[model samples]
Target: MTHSKRYQHRTIISFFTVLIVFILMAGGVQAGIEPSKVICRVETDRAILPAGDSQNVVLKITLDAPPSPAHIKRPLVNLALVLDQSGSMSGTKIQQAKAAAIEAAIEALTRLGLQDIFSVVVYDTNVHTIVPAQRAGNIQSIINTIQQIRAGGSTALFGGVSQGASEIRKKLESDYVHRIILLSDGLANVGPRMPEDLGRLGAALIKENISVTTVGVGTDYNEDLMTRLAQKSDGNTYFVESGFDLPRIFAAELGDVLNVVAKKVKVTITLSDNVEAINIIGREGRIRENQIEFYMNQLYGDQEKYALVEVNIPKSTSGSRIKIAQVDVTYENPFSRKPEKSTGISYASFSSDSGKVARSTNIEVIREYQLNLNALAQEKAIELSDQGKKKE
Candidate 1:
């Protein structure tokens, strides 16, 4: 069997006549918006699919660019620093976490030229408010509060996150980029201890325009739970093998937050007739009958975020023009402090000519698909290895 038959189950021949229209509608303020700030480009792996047979097509949608320097100014931020003070985090782990919270996380916000808000919460069986949501102007005061955090008792991971979310809610602003940075080293031992509970908490926070980024220091933390929290909130997750790397990870995350140009970023994808919407690869999203909806907490300056949709293309005859997908993005522009929308439409024409389908293949989309395939293979290998070890 040929490679195409082994992978796709059948050979697909098609050509793409994609027409993507990216319209920025901000109530006529679109003219003032820079084109480079945010961009949406879509690509399909192959332009043509096998007629009369459903074939899989990958839709790669990329949102590119960081905010410009001028636009980066005055992008207000509301941040919550949630630290785990569980007994396992005692010693160098907790100390470095505190250093990261102050020297990296807090300092990065101050450099942004915005009077950003900051709150600190520490948990060890009980949640403690080190600092309530307030202006980041009092640098020394924030540092002093962080210095007082001492690791002890069992982990109350969920409680700490809940408290952090509560503080952010108090000062939630549509213009401010709201985020929670959680540092943990152990499993939750008290108050809503399951990963699902934390995932729900993260999801709820996102609805209120807040995202939660998780940093797991040392090897004792539950990666699944931490990662799930970040996924639900559309936030970043970092695994630090050593305590010293915590500060660097925190700095990188804060830098992204400081460079945010848009908040509450959502992408709505509507599939055309005869096309079925599948799951979004590597992202938290919902696929309805024919529509897909997913969101990112914010779009940072100089960053590229993308969504991959595995769509099923129904069989069609040659010379047929099919509407593949329509993408609409809605986001709160930090510069304008108003909601902005961008829409793009993709259409493909069916072609039975093998040469045209082969020539029309997008190299970028093919590369992405191959990369994901490699990742899935690696995951399978790891799973098999673990199973073997269990059997041994």
Candidate 2:
């Protein structure tokens, strides 16, 4: 061949080589940029998985820290005030409880400026709604109802909460933040009184986009029950040693309720056909075939919520990339009063070479995984010690 023809042939070959390299790297690139609503990141411990092996994947979802008061546009609130009026809550505790409720009600009337709703239910042996849900215009009537409440009978903690929830249901609206704030200074001694029952009830309320925050005043209340109820409902739990602190805790709960930015947040993670989702660690989620779904009642101004999914991988050929899972989030944006969504995908490459897998390890994922393991170990140790077993 002539020299000029040879030079042109070499240039053509180099161009085709570069094109092939780009095509190979394209699969490693992320599908799109992260969503603005949340910081979602999917990380695997290593980039390459061994054939026929399983791996754990962590989804780190975070919202920016709580904004300043001036920056947050408070939403309309539908609040249920469930107060314990048993004999144990007499004197200072009951007086302080009434004060807290009044303070919270006054703030809603003066500062929120929205069409906020309020309901009051005080419980003893029986539960009754002192004030059914209404606009925050009747401050005098509410104060009178609260003052009439006198502590005497046995505690009907469950009954009071259920009655409060029913009151909020009467005026439930999509735009309003629905919440039940329960304050108790005594154990539940009447009606269906069980921690599991309260937890299940709290979980059911979350499905209706309502969260329950619990406040335990004094040491007589069941801390375990209070915490479980709040956790199941994605709400806050507070403990007050002094009755005087009731007002502050109530105010803090009101602040959190008004600062809600997103509601009805749902996360769905679908694993690829080649992989089987084994289980979800830490958080409770529903599993349908290979997909996992989690329902969150509300997302506050600053919070981080995440789930870790473990998957089993089928054997694959070397130098091939496989999609691990696709995560989609749907939420009601309070600012826009419309539904918004974000999507992300996770991928892992397979390699026969062990060295490549070692080099591609994601340090962040490994560190997090190790930390989770450490936590689990500590929990197990505590459990064993509680059972009267030696550490060794």
Candidate 3:
């Protein structure tokens, strides 16, 4: 909901007064190195639950930023720039967007790791691959091609993204963090154009570990479609009211690219025997027979990523402890060039004291749960509006 503090990360203080944090200590991480340990925490909405009938509870699994990456070589980035060269971006909008894109690409290319790859795809009524995915060695040629381009056709937003993702898939290796930065100045006029279309495409792309950051340039662009794609793909989305801020947005996106510390992060929450998970709040999560899972393409340094799962908890005897869930996290640590794993379990005790149950309420988790509920309401409203049932 806010971008002002996008880069300002908060320190993680695991479940305060009313919660418990358990770190999963494993046997095989490189010994002696402090950063080798996974900075993950598992907690519940309360340290204690009521000793009566079934209760629905929230389970939170947090992955604190791993250690600072100053000591290790940064990971490779496989990036694609998808530019909308539609008829609407005729004047300053097109000019400024091109200038900003070229500037950002050149700057990133100058210092990219040997394994990093780059590509550029421009789209109008039809999608075109202006620059195929390749190492950053031909700077002048790339600039020349960008400068000679002109804008005049309708927007094929879907095709543009599809082509961009296809290019990145060329070198989709575990060593590289794949991303597509799409900038647009018009609504989709050709091909699949609805926000739902882009959302479905984004969801599919993320399965391959590729994220598409969408930048809506000027007031004419469709914010709904842009944000839908980004949200579905687990990428950042920006709405720039003016073309003047295109360069700034592009640079900020690059900054995030460099801050990546881990990639292909898979977090699985296995519910205990009796607990039944209702759903994952806030973001997309896969629910299995007895497990809930979430995935992250990459994690930034000191950035906190977490998941909230709503579960149906069975009643337990007063003073008895009942297991809730266990967390298992697996990610590729680019610095160590190896896969890593972390695990932890959470248990809640039953209390007959009404006051004790009330006092054990986790404020933070409750706040997150409220936000998730609000998001769900908004989503329902949008769907209703889309169905032409606004009055209902």
For candidate 3, the C-alpha RMSD (Å) to the true structure equals 10.5
**Tens digit per residue, CA lDDT, model 3, 111-167:** 444446777788999999888887755555665666555666799999999999989
lDDT of 3 at 247: 57
List, residue by residue over 1-392, the lDDT tens digit for candidate 2.
Answer: 33433332232222212211211121111233222375455667787776545545454433332342344345567788888767766533333333444454444444445257777788899998887887645454455555556557899999999998999898775477888988787899898777898999998888777889998877889876887888899888999885556556655776677667677888888888967877666666788998889877777776666666677777677888888888888887765577877777888888889888789887866666677768668768866766965532
Q: Candidate 1: TM-score?
A: 0.81
Q: Estimate each model's TM-score.
A: 0.81, 0.74, 0.82
Residue 80 local lDDT, model 3: 82
Q: Once model 2 is optimally superposed onto the true structure by TM-score, how far is the C-alpha of residue 342 displaced, in angstroms? A: 1.1
lDDT agreement of model 3 with the native: 0.74
- After superposition, the stretches of candidate 2 with alpha carbons farther than 4 Å from their true spots are 1-36, 46-73, 91-111, 244-248, 316-319, 350-392
Candidate-wise lDDT, in order = 0.70, 0.68, 0.74
Q: What is candidate 3's TM-score against the reference?
A: 0.82
